[model samples]
Target: MGKILRAIKKIIPEPIFDFFSPVYHWILSLLAAVIYWFPSRRGRMKVIGVTGTSGKTTTVEFLYRIFTDAGFKTASLSGLWFRISDKSEPNLLKMTMPGRFRVHRFLYEAKKAGAEYVFIEVTSEGIKQYRHKFIKFYAAILTNLSEEHLEAHGGFENYRRAKGETRI
Candidate 1:
């Protein structure tokens, strides 16, 4: 199944893929959620979403420390890396926000690790791609807003709206 999916992904032209990416991503996000058993609510963990033009990663790291210090089993996902309980590793993908499947997998792993809470660094690009879909956040922290990734997000307002979607 994985091989076939990979092959199909490679066969799709970049231009065509980009044009249809929104719907494609939305469907894949939904599919991943179903396969992962709806990670947003399945783990019984409180998910905290942190978003902003800058400092999201740092904030996630800080929250991770705070949660761990408070004696709660915690997990965190950011562009830098991800931590599940006491284990940690680097995110070599170079993507601040990976696809929904990867996020679901991480959440599922965190749940299996008995995490009481998961802190996530949300990005405007990620939200636009629906990468934050299916994650039920208990709280959302907006560090600050600014004009960044304007071209990718189509404008400052669009970028802002995408980031705002994480709160919902």
Candidate 2:
């Protein structure tokens, strides 16, 4: 555990780590609640999950724009930004996967923001880490598949299973 902590400290940017401190504990609490209560149930918010090697961000943005244009309160978490009900803020964490419980916290925030729809980009690593285990998605979009993350996935079939099988 000490070695892992030291490695994380060495790798993560100081500013990013500092920014996460306050929200980090709050997020953990939310994660615990979600795991304990709604482990297999979808919370009140309607979830839309987008996954693929590419276009996940674009698709999420497009959906967000559509929902905002339709005058419905919506929240979205993608590679580009974290949006809450027509208001968007940049995600400076610079992390593809923001820890195990960040998604649950994002959903909770969306609920507090009175969002009727929530959009998320589900990454392969997130799936592998069981980060997507608890949330239930109403719909999912797969843009395309490609030879990416071979080093992490070990093979193309495994990569595809990580990204594609989530739709099942």
- TM-score, per-candidate, Cα-based: 0.87, 0.76
Residue-wise lDDT of candidate 1 within 99-159, one digit each (tens)?
A: 7889999998998899999999888888987888888899999999988889998898888
Best by TM-score: 1
- Which candidate comes out best when scored by lDDT? 1
The residue-by-residue lDDT of candidate 2 on 109-139, one tens digit each, is: 7887788888888888877656665577778
TM-score (C-alpha) between model 1 and the true structure: 0.87
Model 2: ten consecutive residues of lowest lDDT: 35-44
What is candidate 2's CA lDDT for residue 102? Answer: 67
Q: Count the backbone clashes (under 3 Å) in each candidate.
A: 0, 0
